[model samples]
Target: MTKAYDLARDAYAAWGVDTEAALAALSAIAISVHCWQGDDVGGFERKSGTSGGGIQATGNHPGRARTPDELRADLDFAFSQIPGRHRLNLHAFYLDSADNPDRDQIEYRHFTPWVDWARDRGLGLDFNPTFFAHAKADDNLTLSHPDPGIRDFWIEHGRRSRDIAARIGAALDSPCVNNIWVPDGYKDTPVDRMAARQRLWASLDAMLAPAHDPAHLLDAVESKLFGIGVEACTVGSHEFYMGYAARRDIALCLDMGHFHPTESVADKLSAVALSISNLLLHVSRPMRWDSDHVVLLNDDLLAMAQELVFAGLLGRTRIGLDFFDATISRTAAWVTGVRNMQKALLRALLLPQAHLKTAEEQLDFTARLLWTEEVKDLPHGAVWAEFCARHEVPAGTALISSLNAYQQKVAARG
Candidate 1:
């Protein structure tokens, strides 16, 4: 069973206007305003090319797909749904357009514009560049995608994107980033140059390590199962750390919804903890191999949360509510879901740290019982355990469940 999503951590009523509420919600929370609707990191209005709302044929499509103003508007709504006052780690993946790189990637034309917007609102920044060389390099050949216009992300832009972060002053400081799931892995025996693909990120880390600043931020590697031959930017199910550690402050970006139904969340966390930075968690009734970032805690609440927590990922972990909205009213649904998560986090924070330690390290009990004991779970578990437990709930299940129940009451009203 998967983990039950905790939206209550996101939606509890603000205790007061003080910065404490904001600080409590800040590090543990952030969102990809656009991923709610697939990977249109630009949040562009999607219409057929024939339709006027579609991306227009232009030299630069800053306003063609979506405007910077529209993006800011979405975040404003996001901040409201999040519990208490907080900051943001914005995604600008749409900026990497065929026609324009800077405007489409992490910018809306000029760096100062985005900087001004965040500074005005007091939110921090995180974004990717269109030209970063992250794609699997096909220097000698051109590849065809089952889906048209989808560039070979691993070959073309993987390194370019990484390079931009090194060069850009702003990107270096943003709290977090999302690495595109480069679908370049070869299902066949003779693959494209694997060494080159590996080198792309390695070089990036080697170059940036000297310049990396903890204050500048970390990178989150988003993994995937299908799309491009099951071979994506994440490297593979195991050697995840090899690719991630290449970039300074970089970590694995786990999307709860990204794995196949068979893949256990607990197992995934255990296998990939060495590289984890933040979680791009998704929740929803899943289809076969499809990604639906919805709110589906009730489907299997206990198992989901338990696995996530067992893997040492829960409280104090940065969360991005990846939800989609078909209409403006859906914004309420998305926001409500986020609120539920925040409320659940509160319960997790209250969990006793010492008791969890014994069960997890000494007793070697199940992840479920590790936190249920009288004492709290300590922050330091065995290195191997830490590798697996990415969402360690600081607070206990009771607090999280109670707060979540309260939010359910609120959801019932709407």
Candidate 2:
């Protein structure tokens, strides 16, 4: 492995790319792993009847975490196989509450255990207010609901969510990214789109009225093109959130799966970064629609990583995984998604960006094209294996056997 890595290192150095610097940089970037993948998004909150979120996980794979302890244990095993230190992204519904409080009534005390869990592991935390899969969201409107009571209920929930996030960040000594994504829209065309958007703007203003220290909390608004039922129109459209984020001077979250099939989120990164100070990225795979499939080493993912590197926005971007695939081993899904994201970043770092830029600047398009294709065949796998070895994680197909052993010994117990 050392011999292969040395060869690859020399090769990369020939292109003026420092493999050591790349590794060090990659080690510092932490990807936020979502907690819902372990439980199919059925949060710990005790609810009656069916889930009402616009989102849905299709599979009923065995070994789903039944409790917070089990989920944490599963995450422990998953994180062990993945390289680099990562943060955990949590929804409010995942609270460790015995009293089963309503969403609007949730408080910081309910999530202290999670803060302790993250602190113990030396991990940072990110949060989201659960605006879906609840009784209040049954009508498919929240924060933008015409009813003052429903709107007020979600508003309080959002406010408390921000406060809870601040507390968690203060406890962990890291700024928590509190992202708001409301599943409010219509199944068909609405007569009054202006009214719904206007109401949503007001709700957001009220929710964000409370002042919190920027050092401890960063607020972001996420937009979706559509969801399962809200097909025709989504109140929190991309334009709405972009305008809001700019006007409010807050971070705007762009989910890779939350755009049209033809749209490249990679292309939007540079444009949005010009206006927004910070950006939150929910990395997920979209099959046709926003199916939220497990992320893979695909073209779009590669392009996104390259864009970040080219734009010099890697430091300002908050990357988080947002897929929930219950068809496979949950822990394996976590490891694969997180590792692939890291891999994409590593590939981008290994590129000969300087050479490519010089060629383009000199009007040598052919040379630029040649260099791009040439780097594609480089020994990136060897460098990646060396990276895994340095990080003390299973490299190559060894991760497969480790996951199998885990499923048999640990997950099977659940």
Candidate 3:
């Protein structure tokens, strides 16, 4: 350990916080890193089309992975820079196979390469069904489409996705979280929102009817407020999925970018934890809307980590990142986002919660406030540096040269 870390540890110990315990806790929490950012949400499926269903990667940034191998290479480098053993969050369309197959026809064998790769690296995998970027979803509808045929196609895709997730989890000895998020809504005001929701309800029920071992697969549903085309109405609104997940006793995914700009996802954690057995967080930085910007070490992110630690919700919560920024180096984006998340979590773990909670319980609001603000200026950076050093990962400016070199290497993909 460095002298700085020792000093920082002693300082934290003065606050009745065990820095060693906090570091151990931080190491145990794995952040599920999304793979879409490596290639701007472009999957490797043959005959893939543009992402039209409110999903768009807005940049001509070079080095975008064109194949599954290239994407995995990028992911491999990205994971090296991160400090912990994390999981990979994958979309269904990111399949790897020699033969072409539609979404509904996909099988586990198609994704065996990914499973094998993850297994070799001792990593877990989570999954999502691609509900957009196809002829079926061209109208910004899928599960809730008015046409029965389209609905059936997406329902089958959902079923296939769950099976794939189960197989992946079983292979890796981890429970894969299968999350479903559809871009089903209306650009203009719809005549009947109820009809669309009814169809969605039926479609989801049919898709999730088959049961899988909870040890292998955990199902989650994500909600969105609005999207590029779906401005007026989003069929699967927060309220809709909140109730659905509660009734079905499944996980509810809360994306930071999916809610209104002013809303606090941190506050919703404790409230939603009461209704659902599991909570999946899609951690993203939303500017004014669902911009999906790279996460930073900002107040919003810190508040979320604080809530997860203080509320004692970490055990039941699955932390997953959801951001796609094609504007910068893709691997660098992953490293920065994932590292920032870890930093936030470490800071939360280092908090003197016992003192704060005791003060709160005793109605000493002044002491609570003082301590809350006081902990903000603690030596979190020193401890975080030690963590990166222990993991043999570069910290701060050292990563810039590595990212620059990788960018230069991949720039030849033209």
lDDT of 3 by residue, 1-414 (tens): 999999999999999999889888988999999999999888888867655799988787889998999999999999999988999999998999997999999999999999999999999999999999898999999999989999999999999999999999999999999999999999999999999999999999999999999999999999999999999999999999999999999999999999999999999999999889999999999999878999999999999999999999999999999999988888889999999999999999999998999999999999999999998888999999999898899988898888888899998886
By descending TM-score, how would the candidates be arranged? 3, 2, 1
Model 1, 250-343: lDDT tens digits are: 5565555556766665455555555544444444434565344445434333344444554666542445555443432333444555545543
> Which of candidates 1 and 3 is the stronger one according to lDDT?
3
Steric collisions counted per model? 84, 1, 0
RMSD of each: 11.5, 1.1, 0.9
Best by lDDT: 3
In angstroms, the error of model 3 at 84 is 0.8
The per-residue C-alpha lDDT of model 2 at residue 7 equals 97
In candidate 1, position 380 carries an lDDT of 16
TM values, all candidates:
0.56, 0.98, 0.99
Model 3 residue 246 CA deviation in Å: 0.4
Specify the poorest-scoring 10-residue window by lDDT in model 1.
48-57
